[model samples]
Target: MEPVAGSLLAPLLLAGAAFSNHLTDSYGATANYWAIGLHISCWIAQFVGHGIFEGRAPALLDNLVQAFFLAPFFVWMEILFLFGYRPGLQSRIAKAVEKEVDKFHQSKLHGNGRATNGKIIRTIASLALSLAVYKYAHGDPDKQPLLTRWLHYYDSMQEDFKRKTYMNIKFVEEAGKDRHLFETAPFVGHMELKFPE
Candidate 1:
């Protein structure tokens, strides 16, 4: 009905990014809790805004999607950050989150093969949730304007994250460098280099 939810989402995401950065700076490899908190907060903010402020109810099904699937999108991002992607002011914050996740898995939280499986599961879950939200909630022509705008923002973010991730992995594969996989990663000019634990 209004741009309230969309507008609020931008700040929510920014806040999450800021918070993550702070946590990363302070705790380094032990920032999983911060990532989880950010996801949970985002979900609550969106849910409340859509249902209360927008007066849209947002459907129980939509609520479920937010709770069960969409909430973890951020968490998955954190896991990806652990892999060595550097943070960019011009890029999506998801890249940073993913690097954090990789750090968690590589360190004390070592999950062995199961942790890798968790990443796969989370990926599937996020895709399924995004599809569900897109197909069901974003279909109404009346909502197309808002939905399209939101998707545009989301896509830009997702793309930035994906691009950085691809480049980081490619660097590792080609140079056989493991620096991009560290938790206390160093910032080098415009690129990020992760250190080995």
Candidate 2:
């Protein structure tokens, strides 16, 4: 248990730090869109890594969470496309909504202009979304067990990546802030696995 737990400590800490940074950095305005987008990308990446690269099934909890995160984007996209065709819906509104979508389009026509912006926006949106999910999921210590269990699943699946006994634990010193520090931990150190993957 010590070695297995140690293997997860560093990555979990790193994920917590990264998640904190993401939440704090996008706390206001249109930044939430960017944060959610980034999280969506991460979900997709993890899904691909687990299903394709790792040749394993992704944890059911993770898949459920990913679906939850994607629900907003899918609904929003549908709304945008729907309003795009409605008569007398302000042309400006349509254009603005369309602009949001332009970012998702391939660069075959414009040579990577919109795609780059879209990538940036989506990344931020994804992060913001993840922060919200984390907050909700972690809102109660009782609920945290479910998340921790999912993390355990994710970590267990990553056994192939485990290499050493030494671990670096990352933790958020502040909520919704970018302050974080990593602490070296022995295999037997006290550390909670948050986001092992």
Candidate 3:
């Protein structure tokens, strides 16, 4: 909540500094210099909070574009939570966010191979789907049914990916014994799943 509040308030303070600079004649330069210093200090503090306290890189490092727009909205949501709004869903949302952050940090500690594997799997699946779509669009009328079936299968696979929250390569070891789990599991393309002999 502190971070969220800071995110909301910092910009307004900086804007005030700018307005002050614009209003003053001789002191305008001094005001601009102080404003710039304060802005840089705030950013440095944010970085320290993320790296030292949170033990993770700030979200802005990953997505500056989205962060610019979402930060205020996120702060608003935090404000609502503080006021006891969204009582039922807020806890769930908080837990999910915490889990994701833990996973992200764990992946970082584990050398990021899991992250790369996930990306590779997604890329291959995307390529396969794109190829299927292209062939379906360009192929003969008689085989259209087969192509449509193939597309539908991939679409279902995508839906399965979306439906499951814990879809990761770590689940592959258990997926063989629990075939039903695999139905909703994320497909890691080209990874062979083997059971104990």
Candidate 4:
């Protein structure tokens, strides 16, 4: 609707602007007055249509900026859409909008619109994804449950970390020469460095 309206009106408006300098001041004022009148009439018509036909209010009432500015930008994009511009992106956007609208209506009908179970849903998705990856890498999960296999994977990760940090652990001499340094450490907390005197 917007693209069609713009395509029809834009050329005439541009032509009027181009020729306006040739017109007398009174004529230009008349044209401006006529344009304003048409705008107001169209706005009223829109309100009537929304009230009678659509059974809902215009989004202009909700957001003037979105209705006036963003709407024309979208209309321009729609005009370009006729030239096969980002068709896949447009369809994906349409699908996502449809999905969101459906979710909104469902939520409104059921109860509040508050986002519920989002964390639980994410945890379930992550667990399911990990389980699938685990099965792909290590065969059937039925043989050795997801958590059990996950624990084995976790143990290997800890082993890797321990290997990387091995330099931090003080090693005793073969005959336990520096064993005294190790024993002088507190039962808990930091140990005083026992340098050989």
Q: Which candidate is the best by lDDT?
A: 3
Candidate 2 structure, TM-score to reference? 0.22
Question: How many pairs collide in each candidate, listed in order?
Answer: 17, 17, 0, 0
lDDT of 4 by residue, 78-190 (tens): 77678877788678767987897787667757864243344335434644674577467446535653434555587699999998667445343433656776788668976
Off by over 4 Å in 4: 1-26, 100-197
**Residue 141 in model 3: lDDT:** 61
The lowest-lDDT stretch of 10 consecutive residues in candidate 4 is 113-122
- TM-scores, one per candidate: 0.22, 0.22, 0.41, 0.41
Candidate 1 segments exceeding 4 Å error: 1-111, 141-197
Ranking by lDDT: 3, 4, 1, 2
Instruction: Give the Å error, residue 27, model 1.
Output: 43
Query: What is every candidate's alpha-carbon RMSD to the true fold?
Result: 27.8, 24.8, 28.0, 27.4
Worst 10 residues of 3 by lDDT: 143-152
What count of clashes does model 3 give?
A: 0
| Cα deviation of 33, candidate 2, in Å | 27
Model 1 residue 67 distance off true place after TM-score fit, in angstroms: 16
